[model samples]
Target chain A: MKLVVVQVLLIVVVAVVAARLFRSRGARAQAIRRLGVLAFAAFAVVSIIFPDVWTRLAHVFGVGRGTDLVLYGLVVAFLSFTVTTYLRFRDLETRYTRLARRIALDEAEVRGRLEGGPEH
Target chain B: MNTSRQVDTSGVWLVIPLYNEAAVIGDVVTRARSVFPQVVVVDDGSADDGAEVAREAGAVVVRHPVNLGQGAALQTGFEYVRSRPDMEWAVTFDADGQHQTDDVLAMLEKARAEDLQVVFGSRFLDDRTTPSLAKRLVLRAAVGYTNLTTHTRLTDAHNGLRLLRRDVVERIDITQNRMAHASELVEQIGAMDVRYAESPVHILYTDYSRSKGQSLWNSVNILVELILR
Candidate 1:
């Protein structure tokens, strides 16, 4: 198979996105994510206004068609979205676990006091 | 019951993570309370009256408002045990009555005799526990994966029966809120610099526990959780 410029670029971008899924998470990461989203939205508007722009850009990147480029972009976006959603749910679970544990312990403590304390 | 031969196990607390095991939880709690005076059953939002049964059977029941997994229930029990200054040891026992109280006493004895901080109840240490061929294969694979990932080497890593000293219990923070927590616990304990040993335990696979046992397919889920975490 002939290696195309777009293939190499897509591989690099996908690798970076995958690595970002496991990398550091903080204000900086959040800023970068927001910036990516803003850029994506702006590009979406541009593509909608000028549909031929993706074909011209695709030609520069050695891709077959604009639709192919969009497909590749969608794959990367979906992968990152899945990973981020999973991590966010995990964080939510941890927080709720701690909260539920506190309530359970506190309730048990109150019940113990009301019952004259835990029996040995 | 000879009072003179009784060992002073008042410092030991049995932490049983209870779910909807209303059929056998009462008898399990009663039997465990007879051997270990301090028993705390963490009820993980059971629809049945298992929590009430545990309470009536003389166990300190800690009820979660919603249904959390067994791992969350165990952590709740651990937190509850940490609050009590009188508890010097905490044993994580199963609520399904598969775990033997005698094995708990033996593990405690081993911990005390060797001055160990952790004593894990391993079914593969001896031939006492007989699981089916398929179940045995899954357990073997689990232990193998655990040993490969963690620094510690053990015959069984997914066993629910474990004796942990107060200090070790205080340091353990289980984040996996499901079946994956077993491997997570072993991984955390392996990372900690604590003296640990494994004792042979007989896991009785009664009809009740057999029905409640985790499906073999959960091993795949556990692996995904560990890897994704």
Candidate 2:
């Protein structure tokens, strides 16, 4: 009964997440990402319902257990998420730094002019 | 003290970056102005009156609207100095009062004598310089990393004090807007094949400076920045 409840909960969560991801406005890459996520979620549901199916698939992929395969996939997915997030932050920081430098240079030029110096 | 000969400091400019250094900026600017003819302090958007204090100490002050890192501050100073037609040399000093003004003058003399484009001050070369064992190890690791990547034989990789010629300053631009710029500068110097020298200089590591300076974890972050970026 607990297993049935967990499966239902997982399906509900994945459906909501997949729907949100699909409805969100973004580039074509995002759509492809949503598809990948949905497919992975469906595979997770299948593995949870039919435990032996995972073991059989694991053997084909040369794995000893299905849990190990899922764990490895989660690790890779997490690392990719971290890298993408870092890249986004890095992009934002670059833009901010440029803005800061421009403001600084403009202020210095004005101050120099007021002090009777040549235009910088 | 050798007070016999007066060194000519006619067109040299000292650029000191201050960030919440209200306790020491005033004295540092005053002392630096005594040695260098033109002292320019870049207040990197500090919350305190570091800019006002530095200006009161007779240093030319330029304020950033927001707090950028030390690298951004130094670049601002460099940009300001580059605009002046009479400026011949640019020296980057620390606002924490760890660097000695006399050593700056000595390095200036050496750079002038050797016609060097850049002169970096290294604390490891001086026996009087004292840092904790852990700090020394971190610095040594930094040196090895810098040397390995830049292919330059530098004893200290992250020294705050440096003297650059006007032409050399015009050649390269500082892109790293933080502590990582130290390593970036070395890489640029090597890539550009600029004429550079390393001088043994004194660095007074006070409790305040050690606290304000880079921590070990930041060193790891710097390594990551170097690799990923």
Q: What TM-score fits each model?
A: 0.95, 0.82
RMSD of each: 1.8, 7.7
Candidate 2 lDDT, tens digit per residue, A16-35?
54454334435864776677
CAPRI level of candidate 2? acceptable
The sequence of per-residue lDDT tens digits that candidate 1 reaches over residues B1-229 is 2233346788999999988999999999888888897899999999999999999999999999999899999999999999999999999999989998888888888898899999999999899889998899999999999999998899999999999999999999999999899999999999997999999999999999998787789999999999876
For model 2, residues B1-229, the per-residue Cα lDDT tens digits are 3434478888788888889999999988877777774888888899999988987898888888888787778888888889888888898899999998788888888998998989999998879798888889999999999999996889998998899889877765776777888898888877888789998889998888988777889889888877654
In candidate 2 chain A, what residue range of length 10 has the lowest lDDT sum?
A16-25
Clashes of each: 0, 0
Candidate 2 displacement at residue A85 in angstroms: 1.6
Specify the CAPRI tier of model 1: medium
